[model samples]
Target: MKKKNIIITGTSRGIGYELVSLCTDAGHNVLALSRDAAPVSGLDIDNCACFSCDITDKRDVAKVSEFIKEKWNHVDVLINNSGYLVNKPFSKLKMSDFQDSYEVNVFGAVAMTQVVLPFMKKSSHVVNISSMGGVQGSAKFPGLAAYSSSKGAIITLTEVLAEEYKETGPSFNALALGAVQTEMLEEAFPGYKAPLSAKEMASYIMDFSLTGQNYYNGKILEVSASTP
Candidate 1:
């Protein structure tokens, strides 16, 4: 496969960082965005560019869009991976928490997609990262009202975008990740056992993004080690 220009959000750590590494290793030009602004070691910085921007902030997301326009003019794939979670019982959860979660998980992804769509070619793909909690509500785990709702919103958004853009050329899909060993999961379930690693999840994500198949568009691709 030829080296394609790819942009991913929330690459400071976790699955986003792993995606950057794997994509670069596969000979794709990667542009990563995060709020932390730290660089990942080992990847060639020349071929891979990292930018610091809070996706929740429309102004900051616009700056990233402008940067991409000036730098590459187009992108072959876009991964909306930035997200936040606040695990608190629905009654105890503050309005601010809900707002913040939606701002990052839903609106942020929408903003970046709006900006990047114009620059994407006909074969471009857009992947939104969600969670298994979004697919099925968990009575077992307590205090996930805000986080789960935000992820649920993403899944719906993916479906809406896919239908809206059906004739527009680019494919849209959502990935409902299950128990990955990431900082977010560690924070949610401290010392909890996870079945998959970031690297493992990243490999599947990259394949879905670059394969040029429409099987996943408008559908939720669940990722889990034990899942068949």
Candidate 2:
């Protein structure tokens, strides 16, 4: 496999962490970003670089951009996986809830794309991690109004970017994922079991990042496993 340069957000835990591990273990050049100062333990020191950057903050993003500019001239893949979820009754939801969700889910993804576009190769792929709750009129779940709405916006963003950049820029796709057995799901729906695990999702995401990106541009794919 050819070595590729990749950038991924939300690397502190779950899918992001697993992707960082899988890509770096495969000897790819990966720059992992998380909101806090947490070291990704047990990885080749030479290829794995972790940094703290809230994707919503452009200043922090510029710092990351500068770091990449110093070493490589082009990025092969960009994954916008940083997201914040607040599950509460619609009536109880506050402005802060929407703000936080949009900050990371929508604005942060946009900011990351903007900051990295110049560094990306023309044939690069941009994958935005969206959710099934964001899919219009899908399985109705309470307490996800703000979170789903934010992701919905990204689903459209993916389409528009894909069209706008079809001739000149990279491919864009949004993976609207179903419930995986993640800490976020556990917290959001206590006592409910999901059909798959975070590692499972990460594996699929890695495949999409590396190869599926070539064929799945401008599509919002709803990924899921058959549940009992």
Task: List the candidate 1 regions with Cα displacement exceeding 4 Å.
Answer: 41-44, 136-140, 226-228
Whole-model lDDT values for every prediction? 0.84, 0.87
Indicate the TM-score of model 2.
0.95
Q: Relative to the unseen true structure, what is the C-alpha lDDT of residue 147 in candidate 2, on a scale of 0 to 100?
A: 95
Q: Per-residue lDDT tens digits of candidate 1, residues 1-228?
A: 988999999888899999998998888899889998676534556678876888878888888778787788889999999889787788899999999999999989999999899998767899999988788543235688888888999999999988988887588888888788889888977897788888888888999889734565688877756542
TM-score of 1: 0.93
Q: Tell me the spans in candidate 2 whose CA falls farther than 4 Å from its real position.
A: 41-44
Top-TM-score candidate index? 2
Looking at model 1, residue 192 earns an lDDT score of 78
RMSD of each: 2.0, 1.5
Clashing pairs in 1: none
TM-score of each: 0.93, 0.95
